[model samples]
Target: MKILVVDDEEDVKSLFEQKFRKEIRNAQFEFSFAFSGEEALTYLADHPSEVVMILSDINMPGMSGIELLKSIRKDYPAAPPQVMMITAYGDSQNHNQAMQLGADDFLTKPVNFIELKEKLLKTL
Candidate 1:
């Protein structure tokens, strides 16, 4: 399965890639990255089912993760990907909004790689 890890931070992107490298060998996961939500959408439009899950940072420049989730839920309703929102703050309002927008899960910053892996496992 393929997973899209979306975040503005370079370190987070690098960490996710490194952490999932071994799993990629087994085809347990193939990873992709998007520095912003709009880029993520563009990537999805081009690759479609190549992605199974989207791990996104909530606060981003062009489009927030919330916007990305809503767009997918609406435009790709038939098989919208499971979105896992990531943020540094645990804002209840954003959390509720994410849920309403169809996010499958949420994670705070300083992403725990192990937990992220398990969550992706559940969705895949």
Candidate 2:
């Protein structure tokens, strides 16, 4: 699976890389990183249809993940790639908005990799 992970914090790249090292090495997964919502959009635009899933942080400096999700759901209306929002808040409002905006799933911050892996397995 090819996944794009978007976050303002650069460390998220290393964290995901480390967490999914085994899958990556086994050629079961591929990953790309975007440091912000804008960057993620640019990447998606440039690579159209390459990414199968996106894991995005909700609160970023420029565009929030909810905004990003809305854009993605609009632009890729047919067979849209799955999007999962991750946030520190874990509030009901955020979760409801994301689902309403067509988010495929939601995860709270300090993500539990084991659960994430299980979710990925079920979906992918």
Candidate 3:
């Protein structure tokens, strides 16, 4: 499955790559990384319907993840990619906002890769 990961942290790409190395090598999962929400939108526009899921961080320099979720939900209302929000803040406000904006799932950082993997598998 193709998954897009959006975060401002440059190291996140390496972290996810390292954590999912086995799945990636086995061709079970393919990942694409975007450092900002704008970049993510550009990628999606360039490759429509290619990404199956998105793992996004709520806080960023430019457009916030919530705004991204809103855009995705609006632009692809009929068949939007499954979105899972990831943030260091695990507050009710963020969670509620994400759910209200059509996020499929919510995860807190220091993300548990094991849990994320399980959830990803279930989507298949």
TM-score winner:
3
Residue 80 displacement in candidate 1 (angstroms): 1.4
By lDDT, is 1 or 3 better? 3
Model 3 lDDT, residue 10, Cα: 96
Candidate 3 — which residues are off by over 4 angstroms? none
| 39-81 per-residue lDDT for model 3 (tens digits) | 9999999989999999999999989999999999988877689
Task: Give the per-residue Cα lDDT of candidate 2 at 56.
Answer: 95
User: Arrange candidates by TM-score, highest first: which order?
Assistant: 3, 2, 1
lDDT of 3: 0.95
List model 1 lDDT by residue over 26-104, tens digit each: 8888888989888999999999777888888999888988888888888788777778888988989988988887888
All models: lDDT? 0.84, 0.93, 0.95
TM-score of 1: 0.92
The best-first sequence of candidates by lDDT reads: 3, 2, 1
Residue 82, model 2, lDDT: 94
